[model samples]
Target: MTSAQICIMIAIIVYLIGMIYIGFRCSKKNNSTDDFYLGGRKLGPFVTAMSAEASDMSSWLLMGLPGVAYLTGISDAGWTAIGLAAGTYINWLIVAKRIRRYTHTCNNSITIPSFFSNRYRDEKKMLQVIAAIFIVIFFIPYTASGFAACGKLFSSLFGVKYLTAMIISAIVIVAYTTLGGFLAASTTDFIQSIIMSVALIVVLIFGVETAGGIGAVIHNASELPGYLSMTLSYDVNTGKAAPYSALTIVSTAAWGLGYFGMPHILLRFMAIEDEKKLKLSRRVATIWVVISLFVAVFIGVIGYTMSKVGALEMLTGSNSETIIVKISALLSQHGVIFALLAGVILAGILASTMSTSDSQLLAASSAVSSDILGAFRKDSSNKNGSMAAARITLLVISVVAAFIARNPDSSVFAIVSFAWAGFGAAFGPVVLFSLFWKRTNKWGALAGMVCGGSMVFIWKYLIRPLGGIWNIYELLPAFLIACAAIVIVSLLTPKPSKEIEEEFDRVAQMK
Candidate 1:
């Protein structure tokens, strides 16, 4: 390898070692399943907020969003960011405190499935089983997308084989996660969030400067038809811009709805040391999200400008996602110090990927071991056995996710979108109603889950292909269908028991 390549590899290696060290240090706290799965509800406000957003952003922030902006201009990407930012703020404001309090009240539930099952006082464990199954189903692909990003990063930067790079990435994430569980994942995610933010700002400032400043970049982009318009899409075939409709904008913004149902993010809320601090966490998270998203979108705009000026080469189609990598590589051309900084920024890509992957892996493993397997066994209270089962399940899930990511042609954005819809539609309505609406019964929850989950598939594969208005995002339609189902079913069925209603009232009245 060249000296530049060696430097980049060393920087990445050091970062990986640091992650593993954190995991090892935290592993000593894993005496029970609660500690492993929920960090014993001991995370601080800053760590809680930063880690949650870091895991939620994933590699999509650095790669997918920028890629879309690079190819289609800011309209699509900007609306999506607006949607996500709004969602992040609203979720923290409305949902975080209640969920944290309710989870503790309901048998100290350690996982989402357990919380749902406990909330309804389900003795048969049907809700827990179904929730766990859905988590595994949706999370596998979500996790796979992160692995795919690793493959792309390595293959593009170091000339590594795609599969080989993907495997190595999977192994590193699995190692730290399996060793330390939730505590390890959250701690490292906090550090990664800082790295990701710094990388975005540094690269954005340098990229704009290289492209002849922000004014020049904006001028060049505006010259292209519809490139800067929020209400038009550029059509490559006719070399013209087409009107963007309200439906399309709504669809793009609906990405925010995904936040309510994301198990990985919700776990952060439940793990915070004190529910009162969530207000502080909310502000921190919102500020970080807004700044990071703005920088990310601009990085794509800068990449386009730099490519046009011959300072960087533009990648087309799905390959356009490498625009961030291209920008980082160009920065390395300046000198030795800049080359090392480029390596650090490249490590930011790995940070984004590993942060999300570890969370997904941990969530999936907890679903299988603590929620699924623990439900069936009489020795479910055995902390040692549960912890061992969690590690083993994590390994199995990592292998399955790695296999799914083996396809060289997979698009990170597409995979994440589908999984995002699945979770949003399936759990978002249930979570909202379960917390705020006293009328939601077990039957209603079940109906909502089924309708929401099924509608995503039906809409995406069946109705969406018909085009026209049906082309709207599946999450919006599926989410509405799920909500409607919950209301109708709950009204038709018998009211929740007095005990359930009383508990709900108690939680609602909490400060």
Candidate 2:
């Protein structure tokens, strides 16, 4: 490796060592499955807010969002960012406190599937089984996207074989996560959020300066037809503006709906040290998300300017996702110190990937171990036994995710979008109805999950291919269908038992 490469690598190694150390330190606290999965509901307000958003953003913030902006101009990426920002704020405002209280009230449920099963008193474990299956199915690909991002980071930076870099990165992530569990994940996530913020700021400033300042960046963007317009998308092939309809904007903004069903993010709400402190978390999370998203989208504009001025090569297709990496690589060439700074910027990418991947692994493992397998076993109450099962399940899930991520050609944004749609459709409506509608029972929840999840596949593969108005995002249709199913199924079925209704009232009435 060259001197710059060596410096950058050294900086990354130091960051990884710190993360692993935090993991090792936190591992001692996980004496039971509750601690492992929910951090014993002991997260402070700042940690809760930062960890939740950090895990939610993932590598998509650094790679996928900017890639879209770089490829199609701000219209596509901007609307998606707006949807996500609105979703993040609303999820925290509406869902965080209630779900935290409700999950705790429901037999102190530790996982989303368990929360559903417990809320409805589902003795048959149908919710657990179906929800667990869905978690495994959807989350594997979500987690795989992170692994793919890491692989892309390594492959592009050091010219290593993609699979080899991916496996090594996976091992590092799995090591810290398996050792420390939820508390570790949350603690590291808080730190990673800071790193992510720093990385974004560093890159945005560096990129703008290299592109001949903010004015130049804006000028370059304005020169491209429809590139700066929120209502029109730039068509790269035709080199012209394409019509962006109202329906398309709505479909793209539907990304916000995904927050309701995000198990990992919800776990942060549930894990807070005190429900009263969620107000602080909400404000912290909302402000950070809004600012970070704006910076990420603007970076794409700067990247295009850099390309125009010959500071970087023109990147197309999946390669556009590496625009941030290209900027960091340029920063590295300035000298050893700048190279080290570039490494820190690159570490931010890893932080984004690892933060989300750890939470995802924990959620998927909890579904399999605590909700699925634990329901069948008489010794489910055994803390050590549950802990062992959860850890083993985590390992198994990581292996599966790594395998799924083996293809180097996969697009990080595409995989995340599909999985996001799956979770949003399958669980979002059910969560809303269950929390707000006291009459919703097991039957409704079950129907909603199956209908919503199935509809995602049907829409994406079957209906969306029909083109024109049918080209709507799968999440929009699936989420609506799921909500409709929940309302119809709940109304048609018998009302929830008095006991369930009383508990719902108890949670709803909480200050």
Candidate 3:
């Protein structure tokens, strides 16, 4: 291999080794199911904040968002980023503290499903089963998207086969997650978050210089129809800017709604060592998110400028997702040291993928082992058994996700979006109601989950295809429907028991 290739490989290998070492270090802490699943509620503010956002952003931040800007221009990606930033802030402000206190109040529930089950005191365990089932169903595809991104990254960079690269990525993620569980995942995620932010800023700065500076980049993009407009997109066929309707903008912004229901993110809120520290966490997370997102979007704009000026070849379709990788590869042409830095940036892609996948895998495993299987076992003190079950489930789910990722042609953005909608619509309304609405009974919670989850499929497949007004994203409509179902159903049913009402009031008043 060339010196440049060797440098890149060594850098990546070092990053991977560091992650494995963290897993080993944290493995000793996994003495109980609580420790494995929720890190025993001991994460500090910065780790909680950075790890949550890192897992939330995933490879889509680097690959998918840039690809959209590279292909369609600023409208789609910019609005989506705005929506996510709003969601992140809102979720931290409203949901973080309440959920943290409520989970502790409600039998110290560790997983989302268990929290729901404990919150409503569901004797039948129906809520737990349903929530677990939904997690597995949605998270498989979500995890697969990360694996698919790894395949794309390795194949484009190292000339490795897609399947082989994907398998390697999957194995490493499974190793760390299975070994250290929540603590390991969160710690590694914090490190990855830093890497991701640095990579975005560094690549953007260099990419702009390579594209002949900011003025030239803007001028080149301005030449493309609707390339800079938030209310329009470029129509390649007609070679003109096409109007981006208000409905589309609203639909795209609805992505924020998904933050409410994401299991992995919610777990971070629950795991934070102190609720007061969340304020600090929120500020740190938001600042990082804003900076990182701005740089990521600009990287795409820079890629377009580079392509337009013949500095880089234009890519289309799924291949367009490689624009960031292409830009990083170009940095290698400068020198060995630059090539090594490029490898670190490339490792940032892996960092994004692994950080998210490990969280997803861990969440899915907890849903299965802690929520589903543990509910069935009469003996609840089998900590070792539960830990084993969790590891086994992680392995099984990772294998399934890898198999799904073997398609080699999946769009990372599309796949992540569908699963995002599923979690958002299905659980978002239910989670909000459970925390804030004192009258929200088990019946209402169950109804909300069922309605919200079902509506996503119905709207996406049946109604969305009809176009026109129905073209709005499924998450918004489904979210509304789910909220309505919960309120209407709760009013129709008997009021929650006095004990449940008192608990809600206590949590509401919690500091």
Q: Can you give the TM-score per candidate against the true fold?
A: 0.99, 0.99, 0.99
Candidate 2 residue-wise lDDT, 1-511, digit = tens = 8999999899889988988898899899989999999999999999999999999999889988898899889999999999999999999999999999999999999889999999999988899889989999999888988988898788888899999999989998998899999999999999999999999999998998899998899999999999999999999999999989999999999999999999999999999989999999999999999999999999998999999999999999878888988899999999988999999999999999999999999999998988888788876667787888889999999999999899998767778899999999999999899899888988999999999999999999999999999999999999999999998998899999999999999999999
| Weakest ten-residue segment in model 2 by summed lDDT | 377-386
lDDT of each: 0.92, 0.92, 0.92
Return the lDDT, model 3, position 232: 93
Best by lDDT: 2
**C-alpha displacement of 96 in model 2, angstroms?**
0.4
Worst 10 residues of 3 by lDDT: 315-324
State the TM-score for model 2: 0.99
Give lDDT tens digits, candidate 1, residues 1-511.
8777777888889999999999999999988989999999999999999999999999999988998888888888899999999999999999999999999999999999999999998888888989899999999888998998898899889888999999998888998999999999999999999999878988998999999999989998887788888999666566588878999999999999999999999999999998889999999999999999988888888888999999988678887788878888878777778878888999998999899999999999988988888778886666787788899999999999999999978877887899999999999999999999999999999999889999999999999999999999999999999999999999999999999999999999887
In model 3, the number of clashes is: 0
List the pairs of residues colliding in candidate 1.
none
lDDT of 3 by residue, 1-511 (tens): 7788888899999999999999999999989989999999999999999999999999999988998888888999899999999999999999999999999999999999999999999988999999999999889889999998888788877888999998998888888888999999999999999999878977888899989999999999999899899999987668799999998999999999999999999999999998999999999999988888877888889999999888899888767777888888888778988999989899998999899999999989888888888778899877777788889989999999999999888767787899999999999999999999999999999999999999999999999999989998899999999999999999999989999999999999876
Instruction: Score candidate 3 by TM-score against the native.
Output: 0.99
